[model samples]
Target: MGNEANARQLDHHPMHGVLKMSEFINALQVGEHHQQQTIQAYTEYRFAYRICASQLRPVALLQITYVLEAISSATRPTIILQNRPDVASLFTIDPQTGVVRTVESNLEPGSTHELLVIASDQGLPQPLESTAFLSVTVEKSNELRPQFDIVWLTDNGTPQIYENLTIGYVLARISVRDAKYDSELSMSGCESICMKQTDSSNVYLLIVCGVFDRELKNSYNLLFLLSSDDKVILEHPVHLEILDVNDNPPRFEHSLIRVTFNRSADQFDVPRIVATDADHEGNARIRYSILDTNVFSIEPDTGILRLQKEFDCSAGEVRFRVVAEDGGKPPLMSIVDVIADVIESNAWPPVFTKPLYEVSVKEDAEPGTCLLKYLVSAGLHWINLYPFDPYLDN
Candidate 1:
């Protein structure tokens, strides 16, 4: 095929499509190269006529098979793909052509395979070989699913998150596996929470996106999904409890209270003071106390007020402040003003100054005879009254 006689005969009598064939040969002689090639994981690739071919010639009419070989030698070059021993079994190349394919099914995405393609020609003295560097990047496949590990927020074996946390506060950490470079993570069922993935290591952070109130809602159910190419790959469900915070103070039913106390009685019982707190658990427990203990006392648990000390019947009024405090950690409190009107009543009966009235004429005194005088007192002053001997001890 390299003889001068055959070359002249082909030039005089050109075959059909010979001009296109000449252009292909010229392009091969010059050179063409692909900087890099990318393919999806577990997919096949073919190099075909892109092998080390320098020229081609049609030998005969009966056999139209073209003999393609390197211009440097008559024998065809052997193509070999070189990879690291660790990943050598993952890829293979045909010795005849440069067709490369993955033999292993489990090829990770975002992995770059650096391979050395050697084309060696069968020369007489020393074989000529040329090495071409090939970079093949495995792209992510939609069929692959994602895996993840989550660090849950919990208290006493119960999953919970503290309320009143600031926005962007991290609730949990998640480490992701088998995820692509373009994979996305999202959360549903909770508008107050969101997920964010880190730039490195594919780690995700679950954070607070809105406000949380334990009194309004105590628990939440959350769903998280991992997607790639707009397709869902994994789903996770989380059950969480919202921890309580002392945000509500005790509220009094009445800001100002009025009561009437009768000094004629030994003690006065006040009406129950009502107060409420809108917090949960221990934060809602309320205790009552009075600022002035000289005349007023209150129950620590029941908020029952009582007049414990004696006061002048002529005293117009008594004013005091009552405090209602909750049992929270830092404790919240509220106050109410109380006014008591003291009055003396005439409904009480007379009392004797001495238990035994032993006047001289008491035993033989008649029913109308005055045995004793000035025996009882009323209010803050003493009053004189006629008394009769009802009984005498022998």
Candidate 2:
């Protein structure tokens, strides 16, 4: 009102219609003075994010992307998905776009992952940070098959199983990885051989149903079938190589061996002894040894008994045993009785018909009378002589 009164007073005095005084008065208004205020747009915050876990598969170029969506806010607020140590390995988030993605393809089905999502507005000094909860459910998928570690396979691609194990021994610890929560193992005809499985783990222990003989069967081919609740996953083949154990002992060709040599003849070797073992390869290799080597020594490789030194007829008989040993974890042994005899020498002693002989003449008849005779003893001698004695004494 004061501005209007002043404008009217100035119009009557000077510059009335000369400088467009009506337009100037129209431009001025008399009222309470106020300061201009700026209005900021408001945005409502959201908290929960529910993602279906079943949608994710291992088929991804880099990573399987999941949308981490939020509501639009005033001043173009930026949304971010936060990471936690507990589920850090499972997933990652984009700060600006709010897109959630997986870090690996090994996510378990039917598992829940928790994360924190923050929504902030474009405030000057500090942005208004809002916290929200993010949850993801891993749905079941049949994309991946169970696998066995390369440690289970040998150079020949066969699994190893030790022999001479107790009734129940763990051959291997096989774990089957799957993408479904209801995956199960079908082990048919396993119990017949005493092969059993642990309740909590996929590991199976080899059972010694009966005596294990490498000579009989060295390995067994095992087929395991894996099936999900919906369908059969795969059939795994494992060849178990059963290692050998020293069990069989060596055996001889004869229980008692008789070896004889004539003392009159030159030195000669006894026949080669033959021994055998049920074991295979190195375990079957038998080494020969004699208990008494004084008069007789045996060749280990050939088992031939050679005369080490001379023996006289006085040594009538020499008896010993030859042992055969096989190469095994614990060597097997056997013995064969050896009887060695020496025949008498070729030379013979003299044998006389009488030591003393009494020869009587016919009452002093002829001067030369035939009386007793002396002879050279037994075996064919080079020279033979028989002499007659002329003794008359009784």
Candidate 3:
């Protein structure tokens, strides 16, 4: 019993050479004579396993071997790869050392590899076999920098961003190459009103974050920076022009204009109908005209009004419309009412006054508001007073 216990304990030690039947018996005695003892054991097993590799790169990942109990006369397992026909060409395994390595370095990113590995122990009629699944996942690596393919919306030979576009409106699209890796995008000029959005793995959008006004800012010089793994790889410059929109109509300082002139005056200077448009380019160009062209005419470009012919004084007060139109796709316009009072020179007989009288008034003034008061000499010693009402024609 003692010899059998010692033999079993020795079986736990690593086996180096061949074992004989006589080695198991240290001593066996019966009736003062020595006797022989024999012991028998069997070898069976399981496996060890997994590996990881990077895409497009060669790697010798790990080794695989069968896990066996310490026993005498046990043979080392032979390892072999049993994989599908499609992936059989991609991997290789060493039969003696059980080392696993890649056959080719052309693995795609995000691809997973599953290999069935078999290990057979050398035994009598049929060898003991054990199987293990070696899972190898090709992880994507950040090796290449981000590349950009930009598409611009253009108008009249210029990249366009229409004024007053809503927030989140896409202005341009960019196709990115090698976008699976970690990447960052940044914009320099016009960052406050514009931003970048990732639409897909290889697509990106340039969108508006705020309103745009062509009158305030007509053009933008945008610098796009693309980075990979925190390193800047590309610096691209883009020129964007803000297209004009007819959002602002031609505006007149005063909606009503009043003029008093002497009946005997043949050719008198008429006040210019000043109008302004808060737009860009052709949208801001103003054209002026008088509806009553028989009495007055206006310059198309300068907005200067002038008397073209004589009018009847019996009407007392003559009213006309002055139109201001802008040059845009769909033109915008404004009209102001003009009143001319024909004062009979024979009755008033006023004289001696400055060539021009200028005055300032608030934009929000009420109608019939008295603006300017002037004193005029009726005769050598007599004086007359007149009030200038800016809203007289309202």
Q: In model 3, which runs have C-alpha deviations exceeding 4 angstroms?
A: 1-146, 153-158, 164-168, 178-180, 191-202, 228-231, 260-270, 292-294, 312-317, 341-394
* TM-score, one value per model: 0.46, 0.42, 0.44
Top TM-score prediction, candidate number:
1
Model 2 global lDDT (CA atoms, 0 to 1): 0.51
lDDT of each: 0.59, 0.51, 0.59
RMSD of each: 34.2, 40.0, 37.0
Ranking by lDDT: 1, 3, 2
lDDT of 3 at 138: 52
**Number of backbone collisions per candidate:** 0, 3, 0
Q: Evaluate model 3: give its TM-score.
A: 0.44
Which 10 consecutive positions of candidate 2 have the poorest summed lDDT? 5-14
Q: Mind sharing the TM-score for model 2?
A: 0.42
lDDT of 2 by residue, 1-394 (tens): 2111001110001111111111111111112321112222222121111222222311111111111122222234355666667777666654533445566666665566656655555533344454445555544434343553323433344355556666554444556554355666554433324555667565554445655567777655455555676575544444355676778889876799887665444445346678878766788889999896588788999887777787776857889889999988678899888887766555566666667767665786654454545565665543355444445322
